[model samples]
Every structure is written in structure tokens, then in C-alpha cells.
Target: MQKYPMTKEGEQALRDELQQLKSVERPKVIEAIAEAREHGDLKENAEYHAAREQQGFIEGRIQDIEGKLSNAQVIDITSIPHTGKVLFGTTVSIINCDTDEEVQYKIVGDDEADIKNNRISISSPIARALIGKEEGDIVVVQVPAGAVEYEIDQVQHV
Candidate 1:
């Protein structure tokens, strides 16, 4: 099995979701299935079918989370040495050379990448380009739009 990179926070979040699914959602779905079963015949019951399908979905999600957690290699950010170079979990502030727009992005695992939160996956094109780069280094990222240039202004480990 391939070990996947995941941040400490991402691991915890997945664990929390698994816990909720197992302890809460799973039982609720089971109860719903039971209630639906009590309503009518198995052949003609839409409620029973829906509830059973929902149960399958919940169980599948639980299994999926468990598998991911089992394969996760948690990367703790704080323990990493405060190097100026861009690394996983380090935040990079960049300035768009063409448009002069500045944006800060934290390179993180795929599970923790949320564009709204300024966290990007390490596999992302921009993050791939920024890797190993240090402050004051200029980076060019190739995207669907085109190749865009950026100057690394700061790299923060935190």
C-alpha cells in the first residue's frame, strides 16, 4: 500500500470524522434502517431501500477513512527546523510578477489543502514549483491559464 502524506491536523480531522461516523452516523443510520424495516414489506418499501443505501454509504465512508488513516504518514510542521526554504507545511508568500498580486499559500498534504484557507497540496503545480525555493527566489508555475511568474517574498515554517 502506498503511504500517503498527511499533516498532523489532517490526521486528527480524519480521526474525528471516523469517530463521528462510527459512533454517531453509523448508529443513526442503523436506527433509521430498523425504523424503515418496521414500516412495510421489503419488496415495495422505498423508505427501507433508501435507508439501506444510506447505511451502505456511511459504512463505505467509514472504511475509506480508516484505510486512509492506516496509510497516513503524518507530517508535523512545528518540529521541522525553521528553514527559510519552502518545504511541506511551510507558508510561502509570493508576489505575481506580471499582475503584482501577492498571495500566501501553505504547502500541505492533499487532505489538508483548502484553497479558501490558503493551504495547497504539495502535488499542486504551484507548490511543486515552490518546493526547495527560498525567500527572494523567483518561481514560475505552469498552469492551464499559462505560465505565471512569482517572486518568493517570505517562507514561514509556522
Candidate 2:
């Protein structure tokens, strides 16, 4: 099994979801299935089928979360001593050389990548290009939109 690199917060989020699914959703679905079964014929019961479908979905999600948490490699960004280079879990400030627009992004795991939150996946084109590069270095990232140039302004391990 390949280990997933994730932040502490991402691991906790998965654990919390797993707990909710097992404790709250699983029992609720069980109750629903029981109530629907009492309604009579299994062949023509819509409620029974619906409850069973919901049960499958809930169980699958529970298993998925459990598997991820079990094989995850948790990383705490604040503790590492980085040498002024962009690294995993480090936030980087960059400026588009051509457009001269400034933007900031924190390199995070795939599970925690949220563009709206300024978090990007380590495997992303921009992140891959920025890694191991220090401040004042210019990087060219290949995206679907073509090659874009960026100058690193700062790298913070926060």
C-alpha cells in the first residue's frame, strides 16, 4: 500500500468523518432498514431499497476513510527546519512574471488541496516546479494553459 502524505489537520478531518459515519450514520441506517423491512414485501418496498442503498454508500465511505487514515503519513509543517526553499506543506508567495500578479499558495497533500483556501497539491504542476527552489528563483510550470513563469518572493514553513 502506498502511503499518503497528509497534514495533521487532514488526518483529523478523515478521522472525524469516520467517527460520524460509524456512530451516527450507521445506526441511523440500521434503524431505517429495520423500519422499512417491517412494511411488508421485500420485492415491492421502495423504502427498503432506498435504505439499503443508503447503507451501502455509508459503509463504503467508512471503509475508505479508515483505509486512508491507517496508511497515512502525517506531516507537521511547523516543526521542520527548511532552508529557505519551497517544500511540502510550506506556503510560498510568488509573482507571475508576465502578468506581474502576486499570489500565495501552500503546498499540501492531494486530499487537502483546496484552491479557495490557498492550498495546492504537492503533485500539482506549479508545486512540483516550485519545490527545492529558493526565494528570488524563477520557475516555469507547464499547465494545460501552457508554460507560465513565476518568481518566488518568499517561502514560509507555516
Candidate 3:
């Protein structure tokens, strides 16, 4: 199996989710299942069916988290030496060459990419364009909206 890159923070987030699933959700679902079972006939019970479905979902999520964690290659961004260039886990500040709009994004693993949080996947077109480029370098990214040019303003490993 291929190993997947993940930031330390991402790995911890997955571990926390797994812990919550195993310690909290699993027990709660078991309790719910037991309570539903006490309501009598398992064949026609809607509560029992709902609880069983929820249990299945929880178990599936738990397994998925476990698998990802096992395959994770946790990278500590803070420990990486600053090279004044874009790399995985590097927070980059860029200026839109056309619009003059500045935006900051952290290049992270696929699982940790959250657009709302300004975390982009390393495999993303913009990140791919930014990688290995130093400050003041201009990169053209191909997006669904078309090609956009951005100037690298800063790169920080934080």
C-alpha cells in the first residue's frame, strides 16, 4: 500500500476522531442498541433499525480513521528548515497579479485540505504551481475558472 503524507496536526486530528469514535460514540451506540432491543420485537422496530444503521456508520468511520492513521507519514512543519520556497506544510502568502488580492494558504495533505481554513492539498493545481518557487516568483495556476497568475509574497514553515 502507498504511504500518504500528513501533517502532525492532521494525524492528531485523525487520532482524536478515532478516540472519540471508540470511547464515546461506540459506547453510546451500544447503549442505544441495547435500549432499542429492550423495546421488544427486533423485526419491526424502527428505533432498533436506526440504531443499527448508526452503529454501522460509526464502525465504518472508526475503521477508516484507523487505516488512514496507520498509513500516515506525519510531517512536522515547524521542524522543517526555511528555504524561502514552497513545500508541503508551508504557509504561503500570495498576491493575485491581476486583482492584486492577497491570500494566505497552507499546503497540506489531501485529508487536511479545508478551503474555508485556507489549507490546500499539496496535489492541488495552485500548490503544485507554488512548490519550489521562492519569494517574488510568479506562478500561473490552471483552475476551473481559467489560468490565474499569483506572485509569491512569503513562505513560512509554521
Candidate 4:
């Protein structure tokens, strides 16, 4: 019963996926299995085996999504008043102290993290260092290359 912290959009995405799996994918897999069964010999039916494997994967995903949704603690960042402090569901703008490169990242739940999209997981090293820090704070993150210093420039709720 571990609670999962996620933004409202993240929770909705997971719910949408669960709905698709149960309503569309589950039925399609069941239909495929039935069709494969009509072919007769169960011992030598490749279609049947493939359908079964697909069904297993679909069912597992459905269960996983359901579990996460049930334990989700959805946070609406827009509804919360911004205090200039870095927090979950907040978008943070940081500047590299050494390289002077500026970047923005939205702190999100583990399942919704996409580095390419500028969304980072709360458990990540940089996010961990940024959490609870206020704008204008300088934080150091340990990367594979070495320790990098970043200055927090802005914190946005949107």
C-alpha cells in the first residue's frame, strides 16, 4: 500500500491507459485466443501461443496500472499557491554554474518521467537536490562525470 505521488495529469494518463487495456486490448486478445482455438490442434498452434503470451502481457499491465492508480496521491500544482520553493509537480528552471547552460525540468512521478520531454523523476539525483530548495539557491548534483553545481533561477507551478 505504498502511496504514489503524481500530478493530476499523470494520474489521468494512467487511468486512460487502464481503460484502453480493459476495454480495447483485453477484448481483442480474448477474441484472438478464441479464433486461434478454432484452428483445432492446441499442440502445434503458433497463433494460439502468441495470443496467450499477448494476453498475459496485457493482463499484467492492466494489473500494474490499477495498482498504481489505487495508491496514487494526485497533486494539482496549479491549485497550490507557489511559494518559490521547489516541490513535486513544480517546474524548475536552473542554470549551470560552471557551464552557464540553462534548462527547465518538471518534477514528476517515476512512471511519468521523460528526460527527452524535460520531465524528471522525483527520486532522481538532481530532483532530490532541488526539492525543498528555494529559488536563488545553489545546489550540487552528483553526475557520472563529476559534481555539477546549478543555481535555481525560477520555480513555476504551471
Question: Which candidate leads in lDDT?
Answer: 4
Clashes of 1: 0
RMSD of candidate 2 to the truth, in angstroms, is 1.2
Give all candidates' CA lDDT scores: 0.92, 0.93, 0.94, 0.95
- Stronger candidate by TM-score (1 vs 2): 1
Candidate 2 residue-wise lDDT, 1-158, digit = tens: 88988988888898998889999999999999999999999999999999999999999999888888888889998788878999888999999999999999999889889999999998889999999999999999998999999999999988
Estimate candidate 1's alpha-carbon lDDT, on a 0 to 1 scale: 0.92
| Model 4: worst 10 consecutive residues (lDDT sum) | 75-84
TM-score between model 1 and native: 0.96
Per-residue accuracy of model 3 over 1-158 as CA lDDT, tens digit each: 88889999999899899999999999999999999999999999999999999999999999999899888888987888888989999999999999999999999999999999999998899999999999999999999999999999999988
Which order, best to worst by lDDT? 4, 3, 2, 1
Q: What is candidate 2's CA lDDT for residue 20?
A: 93
Q: Model 4, 1-158: lDDT tens per residue? A: 68989999999899899999999999999999999999999899999999999999999999999888888889899888889899999999999999999999999999999999999999999999999999999999999999999999999988
Clashing pairs in 3: none
Per-prediction RMSD in angstroms?
Answer: 1.0, 1.2, 0.8, 0.9
Q: Model 2: what TM-score?
A: 0.94
